[model samples]
Target: MREMTIGKNDAGQRLDKFLQKALPSLPPSLMHKYVRLKRIKCNGKRCQTSDRLTEGDVLSLYINDEFFQPVKEEEAFRRITPRLHILYEDDHILLCDKRPGMVVHEDDQGTLDTLINHIKAYLYEKGEWDPDKEQSFTPALCNRIDRYTGGIVMAAKTAEGLRVLNEKIRLHQVQKFYLCLVHGTPSPRQAVIQDTLLKDSKQNQVRVVKKNTPGARTASMSYKVLQSRGKLSLVECELFTGRTHQIRVQLSHRGWPLVGDTKYGTMERNRPYGMTHQALYSYKLHFSQEGDWGELSYLRGKTFQVEDVPFLPFFYNQPKN
Candidate 1:
């Protein structure tokens, strides 16, 4: 028989989970079969798969020694070192300043050019995540920005961190702010706008629709001008609801299309820079919580911000409002 002791990181996890991590080569089918046959035990007593493990617990296995041999993890994936700019990092989460045109998740082409994989690779090098030691608990992103937008995105380093932050986001306790450059000055500069937006998945576009329009969802956001020059205005936007291309579609529908927006913007107006994508940035994030957040409680009442990209220098030089 073979024996192993649980550590802090492995504590509080399920018996099956710890076993999977400890014995990566053991297939789930065989692992369950062994457990059923009393081939696995904790402290010399048969244990259930759902039993939670604790530090110092001595687990023993009567299974064959061959099941202990796991596959070589490093051979599975080559490490990647993308041009990642880190803004804030703690034991629980990592906040990165993502560059423009980088997709957060892969597209239809199955491209791996995503921020999540980049983050994973970074952690792997630091020995934070290892397939040799971990079965399925990989670091994940808590929030995502569009491919063309540049700004702060949160990455959860642990499963507990993911759960806490996602709860805060679900309850609207997490506030996200963006900086966007639009073509015209919106009337009533500061106001929350609500409209129905219908998305065309086939074309990857969304349009503002009438009330009760079928397949349309309600979208709401508040915006105010920070600076303006001639026809271009720098706007600060806060989203109350998230939808596909919500900010881009909503602002464009109001006649103030984004500076570099090719879809809903004008070609004649985009001539100056020969730009292809809209100039939008997710610049800041504010967190507030009253109750338990587990590992993320430290984030409560804190704000993380990133400076405006080439936009501030690029837009500030324009004639002032």
Candidate 2:
């Protein structure tokens, strides 16, 4: 049995929806079964799956406490696959490529082997940072990229570096740019999307509102057409405000969702490779930190992308000898 206390962030969701968001790997049918069997109870009482839960409610889940035995095939693949590709690194910052189909981090599992873990490992491998508890180290990643989106990431090596970088970002000294392949060309080649977003805790989904709503936060981004290939229009995006799913939501709202983004794009547009992760890549970052502002007036960069994939041919042009 596992005990869970509802936090303010999860207050407005249905019991089943909350369970799904909390335990992503567990199937919904199994979660419902536990609810029906009263194996899952809220406040020590049987609650239906549809029961609405508020903040401060205590939930108890009765589960089989069995050790996870890895399947041979899954283990074999897991061993072969490495997450997070390193693009560029220095004493102050590290750049990496985020891959699709991989969650950057698991909120519940809290494993040490996510993209963030590999990043630290990459740092240690280069003899730049020591992650050992015995030695003093610095915090990393001035910002994190979403798992579904492929792009460049910036990480700080020293605590001082982190502080300076964070301040610069807050002051809008850093610029981030992305390359996305969308289905349609936006009416205006260059335009800004300004809207408010509210996250639905129970459904684990976010809603974009044009007007004021509870807990809504403003988001803004600009897009420009780069190149068009067949049905796909390659576009460049720049963010003025960082918000969850800002690019996806804004593009989808404009009827030009990124290619392969089933969550935001229409099924009709998901063709060729149906329902694949959106072909979005973070291509550039410009930073102006305080401490090393003199030595490095601005840090401009790019990350290495895997060349094995056919979709990435345009970016990887040189022949490896």
Candidate 3:
């Protein structure tokens, strides 16, 4: 028999769900049978499978030892060399400057060198995270940026931080600003682009459509041309809707495709710039003061920005007015 005490990260989850994560080797049927047989108890009393776990609750498991063995993948983070460009960090959250070409999570290609793994490794080294002590929670990213797009990404060190951050983002209480170099200067210089976006999953691309189709979603963003070079322009965009590739697709539809964007803009057009990946960066983030963020309340009305964008100086050096 073994007893596990619920911590803050492990609380607020159902017993069955927590069991699934804590004892992956335990068969579902057997787990249910154990609960029915009073083999699994909460605080020394019989507990239901659907019972929501609370902090300070103790779970007594009369199961076999084999079910407690950790999986190999749980130790993968320890093998990785932590490479992080952290912008800000607190007890609850961390902000990182992800460089272009680094993936936030593992893709279909089965790459191990990912941003989250590096973060996990960093936390493990600092004694902030221990997989053995955790049942269902791990340090997780609150937001994701494209693999080829450099930007600021937020990570949550605690489960409450993740929940609050996700809620704020869903309510549009968190504002994101992006910087991109486009092929041509926008005629109006500043305007909000509103359109429907349809994503083609097979092609891994999105297109701006005239109307809402079956799978299309409304996309909106306001952009301002900050500087203009010979044939290229530096643009700052603020997203009102978080659609996939909304800025890229909408800007391309407006004849201002991002520089080095081979999918939306011609490769021949990008050849002059010698950039294979799109010149886009999520440079700034702001947390709106209006929302109640619970533990993350201290972050309200705060703005964090990345000062140095790799593509900025090159475009800003151009002589064109």
Best by TM-score: 3
| After superposition, candidate 3 runs with Cα above 4 Å error | 27-37
Candidate 2 lDDT by residue in tens digits, 25-140 = 56788888988998889999999989988878998888765311212222121332345566766666667766665555545654445666666555556666553331123345
Q: What is the TM-score of each candidate against the true structure?
A: 0.80, 0.64, 0.93
Instruction: Report the Cα lDDT for candidate 2.
Output: 0.67
- Tell me the TM-score of model 1: 0.80
At residue 269, give the lDDT of candidate 1.
89
List, residue by residue over 1-321, the lDDT tens digit for candidate 3: 999999999888899998998888888999999999999999999999999999999999998899888655645677898999999999999999999999999888988899999999999999999887788898999889889999999999988888889888889999999999998889899998799989999899998766848888999999999989989999999999888888889999989999988889998788988887999999999999996788888999999999789998889777786
Q: Ranking by TM-score, best first? A: 3, 1, 2
lDDT of 3 at 181: 96
Whole-model lDDT, model 3: 0.91
TM-score, cand. 2:
0.64
Error of 1 at 115 (Å): 1.3
- In candidate 2 the C-alpha lDDT for residue 215 amounts to 88
| Candidate 3 residue-wise lDDT at 93 | 95
Flag clash pairs in model 3: none
